[model samples]
Target: MTNAAVDDAMLAMREIFPETPLQLNEHLSRRFGADIWLKREDLSPVRSYKIRGAFNFLRKAIATAGSGRVFVCASAGNHAQGFAFVCRHFEVHGVVFMPVTTPQQKIDKTRMFGGEFITIRLVGDIFDQCYAAARTYVEETGGMLVPPFDHADIIEGQATVAAEIAAQLPEGVTPDLVIMPVGGGGLSSGMTGYLGPRLGDDAFLMVEPQGAPSLKQSLIAGHAVTLAKVDNFVDGAAVARIGELNFAALSRFPESQVMAVPENAICVTITEMLNIEGVVLEPAGALSLTALASLDPAAVRGKTVVAVVSGGNFDFERLPDVKERAMRFAGLKKYFILRLAQRPGALRDFLNLLGDEDDIARFEYLKKSARNFGSILIGIETARPENFAALLQRFETAGLGYEDITDNEILANLII
Candidate 1:
């Protein structure tokens, strides 16, 4: 909670790796009309800020519980990798429990980091089930459980980022605003706890995935609230409930400061950063940067802003899905369920309605709803979003009956 503790954590972190860079980003600066600096935590050895908390937790644990104690953690993403890295660094035994559904890339990365020091167990179909199993194991074995973000030690460790930021900023230059992504709230709480007093509470903005607005809903309810359903598209940041300790640190902030960004919209940012800026960002990592595009230009114009680029643990296999979501969010792609007469020329007529720039991405025949008509699912992609309007106008003139299912979650999930 104190600056001295965070400073000590920051100093101790050098034994692991030097500070990640704080670099001025020209593309973001010009686009937002603000002087933007990216605190590139994605560049860390573990490819995230998770290592800071994991290291701090183990350091203090070994000092109090002795080096022989076994450390255990449950995670499917960055935290597991960080815990594994620290375990290998300290030459201590560790047990990592990950969901069975976790990608093999993440599991392999964690194994590589811990080497012989860590034992990984793929348990349960989801994180909650895996976490429950971990708790039972810890109870039976008396192994120390390293929570991803709820504990005081974890918060103190994440606070090191703020310490580094304070030292890394140009002398006599204060940031006008700091943008951070919020999941279980460890990083956001730690950063705000350390810098809130120095920069004033109003200087911070917290972003969350729209599918998992735990912090925003909690703040609105005046207490921590758990979401009943969560979309796991942004796996790294789709926390159903905000951590109790983390919420306490962030509760004072107004609800207005917490922005919930759509998962598809975040993919747009991910693709843009990768294609335009040569910066690959995971869905959660792109949250802060994605929120920048939605902010009022006047609010950040000519001001010094800092956006935390959280992590880059992206799987190349998901790139196609990311691109699809991005295109949908940008309105460059659409899916329609069209009705056509059951005749040979019907297909030609429907094809004629599409503009020159519109390209067919998918064409599926569902079934004949009537003897004279057939239901067809069609997906179209175009270079410009405006092309869809003209194509739809042509369809109306041609008397083609169609229903846009691009935004219909239920139908899209079941069919598309």
Candidate 2:
């Protein structure tokens, strides 16, 4: 896409909402020793950069197909809200197909954005099924399908974000590094296409959730590949397959430019941003920011860097899970199975083994393993990670037969 096209899209976007902020984050700058600017796409009307693509797609479609054309799209959350908002903006009718498993908060927000302009259909249990249903509906009704990322107009629309960043920076200034989260590759591809020629391909870093390394895996294989399974914890960036057009735009970059962050690590960033900066970020939205922790300090120090805060469509109900994941990632929390003597003072003995800073988060007694031993599940949270090592040493000294199940996914899922 040309600068002119992106500029035009940006100009039109003003009719819906003014530009989101491009703020220099002092906390991050102090920590990384870099001039870290945040592209606050989280503050968008739909709480994501998804609105830009949806708006551009709808506007161009209406221009060509005329005002009353019906628009259809398939999305789990962010894109659905974006499509709904744009439909309401243009006073056009839209149909949003969402997975049956989508959060009610997202469903309600999408409905609120669309108001009378859109109708929502909950189909299937996953995004792929919902998307297929949307395609079938569009074919039957002969309506325009506003894809989330895979189309030219959508990419051009998302390119406007890069345009805003270019204009928002200090006069005669350019970012030395641009880090962005990747889902279907819409925002990252658009930004890369717009900035690569001027800033060089080496300047961009694309982050994806470790559980769903669609772009990273695709880059490794020199083509898009579908993931066998994806963890939906980072729902916003957990795409199974990168879009074809988006991958084509991103294919020029080296595979190393793409970073896959652990899902639990993202939770740590989310909690930190919320508590430290009073910023709310969903799991996927925290991907880019979380990558900073893994970057070489030398690479970012004294550099002008921009990390796109992609979205803030977080549900408060997930805070506990987020906190738990964060603690686990930080090594401040752990789960274990202990074989205790099924006699008086057995519980007291285990309690005495815990360090002063160690607190019991969960304790469950399972069936008796033998006449004198009982299986017990224990969860402990400590002030510092080092305390766990000391506590485990004490357990060994006491001759306590304990199994650390913290990293055992299957066992933890089944028992803890």
Candidate 3:
């Protein structure tokens, strides 16, 4: 709410950790032709901005309440780890409720951070359900509930990220733009709160995962909108609804200022950041950078831009899936269901139709005993997206009966 409050939180945070770097990114600068800087919150001890809010909330709570109050929270990933880390820092007992479906990597990380200072309860399958259980637990036990993004203290704490960006910029010069990823809007709103009065509204660009456009939808509807469902691929930023407090801070911005990045587009950014920039970013962390590709290059060509690289808690096991999604999104990979005549050489004919650049990634045969044709589930990976068009033309010439199921959700889920 106040710059003084955010400033105080930033000062308090210095006791536990050093400032995360605001590095001038040469690669992005050159690629976008903009003076691009990255606020590497990913380099935080807990590898995310979540710690700032969690720590600030607990500090204020303890100061106002007492050291003996049991703190409780619910998070699918990053926030839980942050809460656990903060609990260990203060040597206070904490209870973390996470969805049963949460990745094992996150669960392990939270435990590693909390050690004996916290107890983890695996609750319902999704975040909302898990959050409900956490609320119930807090009510029954009379424990202090630490909300991830909804509270005032949490917003003030997260605002330190903006302060760091402000202080770390060369000569304290203002960036023409500051891009931030929005989930429940904690970090985005917090940063906006800090920057709005200082830089005005025009300096910010907010990004959200396309699969979870809570902030975008809310801004459109003039109220916080709850999504019926969200694709949890961008786990840290796929919130179903923007937090009320967070939305209040962010409501002034027009919906056009916020961009929705596709899940696979985020994967491409994640891969690029890791391979090109030597920066490991989770899907949510890559949201802001991914949205840059959607912007008109002419607009950002000579401007100074700062994009917050929010987190780096990526699991190596998910890298393969990330690549797969990236390839699919690029149109270099596709899935199809082909029906071939039962006669011999039918398979060979279909195979010969594929282009030289086309590689068969998957071939599963489904025999229909009562039908004259056998069903083939085929996945093709090509060197370029255009190669797929040529290959499909060849299929038409061969008179192959097939259906492209790459974008068909039901078929993709059932077969692919």
Candidate 4:
């Protein structure tokens, strides 16, 4: 179906839930000197726009397939929760297949949302395997498999976010740019499908995690190309490949319109929003806004822009890692391999060089080299980012040999 039809379908969705807020964010606006507004999909009942797609897909399918028919889906995160929520809403029998390694909190939340209407099955170690198993079950049981994305119905449902954005804007206040995070690309595809023709060209920007730029890579190659490996740090947006249907919707745009937000930099945005603004955003949810920091501020200044915050299903257990990434990105922390003389006063002398704001966060002796020197692993955290520069000067003056390993992903995977 055409995007116009999707827009019509989405308009009828208001009978279930009101349009999510489209609030102008003063803090972000002042920071970027732009008329910045946030399309708060996080305010949905399921705390994500995923539910909109799930409900739309299920409601339409059941109308044709009839009640008592089983619906199945495989998702390790937001999609599973969305599917479960809609299953309960429809009072339909649903089976949710999730990766065995899925977090207990997420599993619990999905179960809670589904209540007695759904059953959970933990299968496979990662999402791919889980998806395979879910499809197998769907075939054997004659159940309908509800795809997380890459479906016409799901895309149509997600397009509602764009419809809401258009309706919520003040009269004559069309956004000059719309930024969205790309995961499996359901939301981006839906938004682009509905708004693409209406806005003509160059009206929106797509943001992807640095670790997973499936859409960007595919667009560059002029076809869909799956990554050999995907970094799951931003689990919400980390997909090996953009969905076929999603890529079709996005393919018309130039590759330059798609921006990749660095994984570490995204952590800085997430932590800042959480601590400073008291807003909790998952890594993917922060993707679109984080890209703003890398853009030409002049281009966005005085222009109305809408950034879709996709989801906020962050687990607090990963908070430390998030903070560590944020600190490193902000330059307030550094990890170094230091060569020190194996003498009693050697450690004391190095400690003396530290500024008041600098504190030793980690110190470990890795190996002994002869009787005169030792290899030390040191992590220093400072109150200000520039303090690290001064600390490096001190090391240089003292002729202390050190290698900064803060941003070394290889070494960090082993030690940090």
Please tell me which predicted candidate would have the highest lDDT against the true structure. Answer: 1
Candidate 3 has an lDDT of: 0.91
TM-score of every model? 0.99, 0.98, 0.96, 0.98
Global lDDT of model 1 = 0.95
Runs of candidate 1 with Cα error greater than 4 angstroms are none
Evaluate residue 361 in candidate 3 and report its C-alpha lDDT on the 0 to 100 scale: 96
- At residue 401, candidate 3 shows an lDDT of 89
> Which segments of candidate 3 are over 4 A away from where they belong?
none
Model 2 per-residue lDDT tens digits across residues 29-50: 9999989999999999888999
For candidate 1, the 10 contiguous residues with the lowest summed lDDT are 346-355
Candidate 1 clash pair list = none
Instruction: Please write out the lDDT profile of model 3 over residues 66-182, one tens digit for every residue.
Output: 889899999978899999999999999999999898888889999999999989999888777998999999899999999999999999999999998888888957889999999
What TM-score does candidate 4 reach? Answer: 0.98
Cα lDDT for residue 64, model 2? 86
* Clashes by residue pair, model 3: none
Clashes within 3 Å, all models in order = 0, 0, 0, 0
